[model samples]
Target: MRPMLNIAIRIIRNIGNIIIKNYEIQNINSDYNEYNINLFTKKINKNLNNMITKVIYNIYTKNITFLCKKKFFIFKYKKTIWIINPLDGVMNFFKKLPHFSISIAICIKGKTEISLVYDPLKNDLFTAIRGQNAQLNGYKLRCDKYFQKKNLLFALNTSYIFFTKKKNVNLINLFVENLISLRISGSISLDLAYLAANKIDCYLNNNVQNFNYLLAGELIIKESGGLITDFIGNCNYKNSTNILAGNADIIKLVISKIK
Candidate 1:
């Protein structure tokens, strides 16, 4: 497992380098037009997937399977499953906002074993190996300490509003009126990582179709002493994208209101 984790770290760094290089070059030749931006994303996603597939297949052989979004592949061999999202927050990155990240999660035998969320721009790496706890760069990470509910920073994402759970609509409205500070950032993966790092205390996102983006952050939250549950407080978060995450106390409060 340690060897696999090391390999994953190496792969993530390699991907980051490519992302940084491309981002800088895009700036020099930056185009805010819709058509060019779409083309740029398509080209980078293809290249990154090729690199990841080559690296994983060469080392792990046929035993590794992938569940990558934007690009999907499933092999007969299924001992190790890799959920890789080459770039999270595509909008932010292309728009010159430095808030996107690259995340990878490895699930072997039906359980997540390792997770890594790397912020290429800042060179910040958030990682966790099951039961060993979570870390940022090398220091351990934990959710923020309990505080007055209003003071807790909230990372609320509503981009996929169309997919919103009708029942939880009240919860969203409630938070806006109740919570002291709220942030509607574009990146869900980074929001989850920030929750685990104590930078944000509560994160609620609705209707995000990319499960690839949630894989690593879900494990990161658990390993860092945070809880993740659906809007109704059920553990079946994987089946749906309506997630409510934070420390136990905050989650309980949110759920009480939702219920």
Candidate 2:
């Protein structure tokens, strides 16, 4: 419970509360289109970015990059960068699904130090420091190892189908045929959080975007004793990079299958 982390959690929770409140005010119908969704998302994103920028400046006095709705606002001062994603699952939110979250991470020289992902719908907060254990609502978390395919619960994003290669599709098919169950949650941050909490055995996404999960979710998984890497077991997970995450044994088995 460091001072900075405490401040960050408070700010994130407040922003989430605001977003949820505003979301409830909208008369969302099943007829909502992408334009309607984008309008609501932009409103929330702008408010969150502005509020977070002001609050973070008062505490860290460092550089900040707010990535919301694919827009970036950069500020300069110290070397530390606060990577903020105001909302993680805009599509789910539009569909009136309660799977989205707010992700924030403090990175220095491309290395994440403090990470936080808050789900306002569930009032669940997942957090971690660089070398400390990951936590969900202050309870420690750890990834569960599943060596047997029949016992594994794999999580993914259906959006992968839109961005994946043919090889990736084949790999996904292999997983679907082997794993006990598969879930597409529409929220990478929440998916990674569940992976760290052992709610899911593994998480695979070949179409990961930087603003989606790279900043906060990656560090949360690593801190929780989970492994994350590219499809080839390399640690180079940049924007648009493929991702495979799980425990050591599970990661090895997945790599072997995909290869």
Query: Highest TM-score: which candidate?
Result: 1
- For candidate 1, give the lDDT: 0.80
In model 2, which regions exceed 4 Å deviation? 60-76, 160-166, 169-173, 176-179
Q: What digit string (tens of lDDT, one per residue) describes model 2 on residues 1-259?
A: 3776888788888888887987688766666887777787677767777787788678756544444346333333466666667677777776677789888887767677888999998999999999988999989987765566676788876664723566666576666677557888878888988889988988887765554355688888999899988778997656335788899988887888778
- Deviation in Å, model 1, residue 232 alpha carbon: 1.7
TM-score for each predicted model, relative to the true structure: 0.88, 0.87
lDDT of 1 by residue, 38-123 (tens): 78877787778788778877886755546544533322245677776777877788877888888888887888889999999999
lDDT value, residue 133 of candidate 2: 86
